[model samples]
Target: MKKTILILLLHSSLSWAQMQPFPLQEVKLTAGVFKNAQEVDLKYMLALNPDKLLAPYLIDSDLPLKAERYGNWESSGLDGHIGGHYLSALAMMYASTGNPEMKSRLEYMVSELARCQAKNGNGYVGGIPNGKVFWERIHKGDIDGSTFGLNNTWVPLYNIHKLFAGLRDAYQIAGNQEAKNILIGLGDWFLELIKPLSNEQVQQVLRTEHGGMNEVFADLYIITNESKYLAAAQRLSHQSILKPLLAKEDKLTGLHANTQIPKVIGFEKIAKLTNNADWSGAAQYFWQNVTQTRSVAFGGNSFREHFNPIDDFNKMLVSNQGPETCNSFNMLRLSMALFLDKNDVSYLDFYERTLYNHILSSQHPEKGGFVYFTPIRPNHYRVYSQPETSMWCCVGSGLENHTKYGELIYSHTHNDVFVNLFIPSELNWQEKGIQIIQNTNFPYINTTELVMKLPKNQSFSLNIRYPKWAESAKVTVNGKIQKINKKPSEYISLDRKWRNGDKISIEFGMKTRLEYLPDGSNWAAFVRGPIVLAAKTSTEDLRGLFADDSRMGHETKGKLFPINKAYALVDESGNYLSKLKPIDNLNFTLDSLHLQPFFDLHDARYQMYFQTFTKEEYEKQKDIQKQTEEALMALEARTVDKINCGEQQPEVDHNYIGEQSNSGYDEEQFWRNTRSFISYQLLNKDQRGTYIEISSLDDFKTENLEITINGISIEVFSNNSKTIRLKLPKAEQISLKIRVMSNYTTPRFTEIRIISNE
Candidate 1:
């Protein structure tokens, strides 16, 4: 046994990794009120209590919305995602909160799903239409799964992956006995499903998209003590993708970096769980490659939410479109696995960067919408979901996002609670009779105060995370400065007997700097302490393809065309508006284009890194391009908006009555199948400097109507309605506006034109 173990370690660095026995026993947190909120959150989800639509789910056997709204799942590929998420949410909620009801709900779901599978008369059961067929073809290896396909086609394995994952999490996290049984049966079914395919075919299918099935299956195998399950999980591995990562190759350019990384992560966990020394080393190698070599200043990968080529960082810097929030989320998950094995601070460092910059920023402030992509260019806007419509994978992760604030708040070994993420929250450890209250705004403010209350005196080391971003830090014990043994971005140890009412105060100083791309290009990115700095845009100068919904993707001309009114010119020193520090009396939005912490910039146009230039030099460059008809071939910038900094993008003139409900607004009128209607009251209106956009595409969807005063109908979407002519009566207060009624539902207003004869 010793010689065999020695050989395994010799083949890979994973010999250094923790080789724990099968079935990790559950551990209790020493002391804290941390688990309470997770319980409340998980219970709320299990209750199917939706706060957004203000509707409680009818406990009816058939989910009416699932049955009616997305019946048959014939075309839409989103059902499995929703169902998978719902199940995973239940599982995680149960595990984290230890709620019995959650476990019951999960068990119930497994039984219901099993019935559905039985009715299908095969080992196939997909909530969506034709998904079973997709899987069948996937088994045949006819299509590549990872290539972002169009139409009703997608990597079916990826979709089913969520369901399998949810089921597994139900067993592991929530301890649902039924879930385990169902998973074992399902695993058996999967073994038969792939038995007919050749190894090459299986490998090809694995190359496409499939969530962490390989990892989850490996876990299931361990629990069942079955080698077949392990073999199946190994077959699911995409050797092509894993080999490069394991070899420490930077072959990530032009790839769906985020989509692939999670699978590799699953592979990593699978390796660790199965005690594969090579697999574990390979997983770690891939993660380190991404963390040290492939990441941007924000600790994120991918330019357009996919990794560009390894050496082409210069190209990626300019084309940074959508950094996949899902990828970073998975990386953090991967980081935790590594931390558990090695207890290394480096893993936590990456975790901290991603948690603060990506995960925290992924949530929308107005609504708890999770983002799919985070745009790093000044002209691009951060888009978000409106809760129900946007439950992408990020949304699934989003459900888990805020609830586990305690996970990062504390990690325990034999004798310590290693505090990682700093947030304003509380932790109560019932077993230890210890309560810790952490209070502070955090990144917004550098000071975080931890107050620990103990029912009895106890001794333990409080390992506080000295984040990698902090240049220097100080610790104060009960208002007195204490000597910290570790450096910034390292763990500061405090081992002592703690009494009640002991307060620890920490001040971390984070500074900003410029980071250049790997290609030695002149392009650079900004980093303030551990947080990446982005150029904030006040408003978007939406060119074409601008939609009313902020969550919808905007189609712009390209990256070279700047968003008008959103940006300010920076000087040679990279200061806004030629070295203008925001005046104390100036508006908060003046810093609108100022450097923002990366995650605070959801749904706004921001430049995380910039192509710097001075006014004189930039003008000279522009002049050379203008004069040289045969110079650099053609100009890199678009003609419409080469540069429109420090000005508001011209608003598309909008028209509407002050009081629509009091006038002609009808609640009975249906929009988007909803009974909601406009509720504005008519009043005296001004039409100065107000402009309505007129472009060529308006000819087809035009609504030509004669102008009216109080009961007016004006042509809005007409190409012929040049100025959006509207008639406003000279009465005491006659409201004037153009109201759009969509043929489908919900009124679409282009511009609200108001004219007053004052």
Candidate 2:
């Protein structure tokens, strides 16, 4: 058994790496269309002060720190997370651009982190608040783990995992030998921290959001070729999420979207390394479920960071918090993993769609700000994060997102080089002494020309991706038309002995199409090939266009325009795309509305999806929408603060605390109730609020429910039998607690709101 395991580990690293696409360092993005965005992202990366980001590390190391910690989440408990992400971003940017500044930044961060680890006098290194004590508690089996917080610490595992990933990237991508040493030490520390805990206890700790600790462990195993790291990776796997996935079950609905994506990426990595078909199949199933059923046209899913029902997207259409940038960031990682595993063009198709629509569109093109959410709520705008102000998860992912655009453009396996995306870039295959330069206007011109420069005559196969969106294509080798035979979403292979200055160009025209919501709703988004087209609405009242250093800075506090006010595409035959008029440079015109690429529409109110109806159907729906919008707007006007019960992040953000409580969703409604007691701190920004409204699907006649505000009981009487409103004795900020004192289970609490009297 020992010999077999040893041989497997020795061979696993080689086989596992072959299964991966070419490293970002090997493929260099040239000066082209993507260069500007890359430069802007570089500016954003360099603009952030590393000293402030490294403060928590300095404090942890007992070293003197000069800069105050950045505000928002950076000052909050999730400290040093940005520093971790900065390491990865700097490493990747340095590799991609060969920039001295980026290399210096990466080196500085690694040195500071090493100093911190050395000062600790243990292998452990993290910026979690009193992180040593926190790990000590978990080491002693004194764990109180929740989905968001563990041992009363705010996602300490998740926070630490960022550093783990950063160090790995630093060693693997940036070729820093010292980083490898530091990373191994930290990995050893983690192993010892959990050495005393039983498997059951380790699983208990895994219940919290750990941000792909297993993935990093698997990566560590690959790096060191050691069995202990692989065993630790297995021990760290979250069974609750993994078991159902292994059985090919879709148990992802109503869960935090970003939390699960990284875990699945890890699962796929482990699967490839161990040749575990079940694990591989589980990751494949998850990818299909998310991309096909859950994700919107922009290739993003979830509402306010939590997945809603797959069969229903009504919440997505109404909520200002739409798809999170972090989710797409992780999804792209998973997509790239799957693509490498099977060489599947389908994964690349989704990857291209998401890369252009969500990831590229996430950043502020000129000002270099990162966006957390890309709201699909008709005319709702998005908030951009400044370097010092916003330390949100999206900000961390956003930093790394733009730095690695050269990653998937071209992937090679031995002698075969695969052209995946249409992005203008260059690749240097030093092993083969070959340099490939691909240039194109892309979606504007629909043609990309690849010029290969080889040191000598080289025998290699060039595989060009025939994307799912291309209707027909023409291939030319050195200006001579070649016999082309390939289907949509398949790669066209050209195997030959290639010499220097060989030019191959592909011309494939894009067609306009309309994609409906996953739930089969009437609302639809337009697509030109992989690019999503959006209509520019009024830019009025775009509050927080740039985010401030506030707790909820990432959220766009702008007014939401009613969905009914959005222009509808009135086409009974569903041939709306056929009637569209093409403007210049990937722009189109439909029904007096000029539509452009969603990625190009920035800092303005835009509509990604439009409700489609025939002339006759529109007349019938118009009156109903108007009536519904009026009521909703009136209620929103009075709402001071609101809580969507059963949702994880919102409840946590609202400072939710409970005993003997559980949460679930049913019939498109999420509810939270407790046999003992549950409470949320509701904010009354002003003392003008006169009442508290609690909406539940409870029958008050059958169940005895007691509700209180700050230890004072409030009388609840049903006025219309649908909702019960408690007239507040005084309007002030208070914790509202609901207790089921009787034997019956408390009714499902759907919503709790503080409303100001008109």
Candidate 3:
């Protein structure tokens, strides 16, 4: 191809088709669609459960990657099987950048996957719960025992759902042709497998953790305009969460909120694409139920990945692990959809809230792994999994979290550009042949400038985001001011043009505010500009869960503690808010404020939110805490890092806080040590959007439940079950409920999973 012809083809085929405006005014890390995505999928993982049926297939099969053997070694790859996340991450990266290598690698993987299916002569693709026996059990109606267990994810058909979605995303978002075929075959296989099963039986399997198979399938159906995928999507829907959403009820507490959000999003997609207004209404209703009724101050909810009990989230503050990165991922997706379709500023409002605080804050300042949740209580630490080690759902989101730092910065109407986020990056809208660079160090510095380069005499409208946090927003061009209203929660547009180089800087003078979490506990968080401030304490001084090794370990080094005690408090007026600043010279810190980024404070413990404990309550718990501390120190002694500094590693997971490290240590360590919980402290702020975190439905699998409607043996599982299902006939007027059985006297459920055909 000649140079002129090649250049023409490149411009036509590549950047012209998709032009995304990055939020930050910086050159973000974006690889072309095919190049960066393939490397991420094929390079980043090291799976421990090689035969788990859902392991990342990128690593060598014999790579010392078994959960049973060498499970505790970081090299063991225990946390590597997250299909939904990885696929999505890969898809997003691929779509954002159209790299041919990425396209080729994705195609190769899909082709290999097709070959794997052909070899198995079954539609299945994964190594986990790795045998075909689970299918056999279901075939014979042997519900007591599963071919494979479900929590973390079930049949991992849920895991495969991720791959299916990834392939679909690659095709739709990035325009990959081969991805379409691979995903279609996978969906057909899923449809065929469930063909012989009744709703009850299928629901029984659904009882196990299945990542958003329905969401991706529904999305695929839309792309392909095929209803079988949609039907299969509906079949996989968990009625537990949807029934309430359909009824406009608020029963989201204690449920795996993120898992259900995507499903709700799938319904939203279906409702929109198929033009089912009822489904559309249900999705909107659910979004309202979860967002308005069940959200926390952080613009997130679902502690420990489930909905907590109604209005009683305080009981689980010490366990403040709600709003998984995955949940936020789903919420953002749903919010974006709502924004695009409805063009509602309200949706964008929530998007802005989470993007800056939760999502942007989720990434580790150093290692780049994303936190699973943005905790709301002090002392619970946040950590990230190792790149080669931790591959949890958060890891997948982590992959996506950083790659799209430029996303949503600029959205457009037919004529004007809408700027949303305040990241320091540039936007090249090639269609208009205009290059607009946003210049500013956001969250650190409160100002941003959008410098535009356009053809001489060309004119257009530029709408800048006058954030809700802005006290005064000004739009000025070339020393001559432009008239624009600084309306709260809406964009301020300036329509005028002409020139080689022009500048319009919207100085949204940031203000500081005290934010309150809604659990009724009194304490407030400091927010100056877009950054949330957290109190820091040292981890070297604390052991076990409070140490640097634990997932819930504190982020601070012994606090500037000895010295911080003096600077930690303020008087009647909020004078300390601006007075307390981050020291200007800390090379490692992002910004210096009285409070630090939730992900950075690895030295001393930090608190985003707090409560004043009664002196008596503190005294009474002294002995109990002592015992806990002793056990914790002992546990920490066992997890030392053998290589670096010859020091003990942090005990990061709450599941292993005071307990001995599990064999899944290395993978566990990636999540535990790298991750920490951040609490937002507010004393009696308004009680809106208080979120509830739920436990897993996997816990329900262990119970002996007899669920029957109309005398049909609706019994779905064995004794000591990992998951059980209760299928419902679709209707808006049926009054149906299940007698959930468990060996324990009472198992606390924080969330209610729902599936609906109504």
TM-score of each: 0.69, 0.94, 0.68
**What's the lDDT for residue 208 in model 3?**
45
RMSD vs true structure, all candidates:
14.1, 3.3, 14.2
Clashes of 3: 139
Model 3 misplacement above 4 A: 1-80, 94-108, 139-155, 292-294, 320-323, 456-459, 541-593, 599-604, 612-758
lDDT of 2 by residue, 1-758 (tens): 00111125445533322534677877877665467788999999989998899999888778889787787787668898998999999999998988999999888889988999999988888888888888888999987655666755678889999999999999999998889999999999999999999999998888778999999999999899888999888888889899999988888887878889999999988887788879989999999999999999999999978887878898889999999999999999999998877757789889999999999999999988999988889988889999878899989999999899998898876567889987778888877787999988887789999999888998877989998999888999888888877898887888899989999999997788889999988989999888899988878998899999977888988887888888888888867777678887589888777799998899899988988888899999999999998999999999988898877567766777776566676666778777777778877876767788888776553247778887899887544464778867665677888887777677788888888978
Candidate 3: minimum summed lDDT over ten consecutive residues — where? Answer: 654-663
Q: Higher-TM-score candidate among 2 and 3?
A: 2
Residue 94 shift from truth in candidate 1, angstroms: 5.4
Q: Tell me the spans in candidate 2 whose CA falls farther than 4 Å from its real position.
A: 1-10, 13-20, 674-679, 697-724, 727-732, 737-748
lDDT of each: 0.55, 0.85, 0.50
Please say which candidate is ahead in lDDT: 1 or 2. Answer: 2
- Tell me the tens digit of each residue's lDDT in model 3 across 1-758: 00111112112221221223332222343223212333443344322132332233423232332233212221222222454344555555555554454455555555555555565655555434433565555555655312123321233554555667667766765566766776777677667767888898877676545667677777766666676777777777777666777777776554445657777787776555555667667788877776765666566676655565545565335443546677777788888776655555567767877766677566544444446655664554555555434445566666666545455767654345667766555566655566766776665556667777766556666767666767777777877777765586776767776576777666667666666555454455666555566666445444322223223332222211211121223344434344444453111222343456443354345666643334464455456656765664453333211111001121112111111111111211111110111111111112221211212223454234334333343544233332233443332222222333433222222222222221
